[model samples]
Target: MSGSPLSALSWRKSSLSGPRDVCCVEIAFTGAATAVRDSKNPDSDALFFDERVWNRFLLAAKTGEFGPN
Candidate 1:
């Protein structure tokens, strides 16, 4: 769950997100942490992984760790 930092923060979602907005992710930079959320349901709760963890996730993603055939 997120704290007050995410309350009034401005979020930035990937521009490549489809028009349907179903397959989308949103991230907010609050200096100390990064907030990730599902664009399909902005009001729903979000997950806050440490920035280091987030970077590791990104590295894995870039290397096709979650890729398909």
Candidate 2:
């Protein structure tokens, strides 16, 4: 992720994001990995995750694995 030029990638904000939202993230899918970046800092470096790992994270999130206990 360090050597790649993320600026050239086409990024999209989540459907949950809104015009008035102050905290949001944007994502881009590469051939081998998914990249995520803070919407407030598009020019900054992004965090990259393997496709499988990203999918698992999404599933867990949907199932409330990250919810407060």
Candidate 3:
């Protein structure tokens, strides 16, 4: 699926995000792709990942592959 424009997609931060929205990242899941951008700098470019890679990253995150959950 083609992704909607970045400005048009709904961006959301994690519930675990730091207070005052600082040092946080926001994400938008666009049908076939996932987008990531700094909450402090939404206007900056975002990194895009395909569904497969995104899923793998999520799995690794849940499994503590990167570090303590």
Candidate 4:
């Protein structure tokens, strides 16, 4: 992590993001972690999650488990 390998990643936003939406999350994957960052602030530090945790979160999201919160 000392060399900032994340900065070299090719970050991508969701296809659903529209031209008018200034606030979106971009994601990049490394061998050890998944990185998420604000599309509006690419220079800011990104949040990293373990691959297993990221997959579980995606599954929950797809299932609508985080409703009304």
Mark the regions of model 4 whose C-alpha exceeds 4 Å error after superposition: 1-4
Candidate 2 per-residue lDDT, tens place, 1-69, comes to 434699888899988887865789999999899999998878888999998899999999989999963
Best by lDDT: 2
Task: Output the lDDT of residue 39, model 2.
Answer: 89
lDDT of 4 by residue, 1-69 (tens): 436776799898999887965668999988789999998777889999998999999999999899853
Better of 1 and 2 by lDDT: 2
Rank ordering of all candidates by TM-score, starting from the highest: 3, 2, 4, 1
Q: In candidate 3, which residue pairs clash? A: none
Tell me how many clashing residue pairs each candidate has: 0, 0, 0, 0
Name the runs in model 3 displaced over 4 angstroms.
Answer: 1-4
lDDT of each: 0.81, 0.88, 0.87, 0.87
lDDT of 1 by residue, 1-69 (tens): 345545577899888877888689999877777888888777777788788998999999889999872
Instruction: Please report how far candidate 4 places residue 40 from its true position, in Å.
Output: 0.5
Candidate 1 at residue 51, lDDT? 84
Name every residue pair that clashes in candidate 2.
none
Output the lDDT of residue 14, model 2: 80
Superposed Cα deviation of residue 15, candidate 1 (Å): 1.6
Model 3, range 38-63, lDDT digits (tens) per residue?
Answer: 98888778899999999999999989
Question: Cα RMSD to native, each candidate?
Answer: 3.0, 3.4, 4.3, 3.1
TM-scores for all candidates: the values are: 0.81, 0.84, 0.84, 0.83
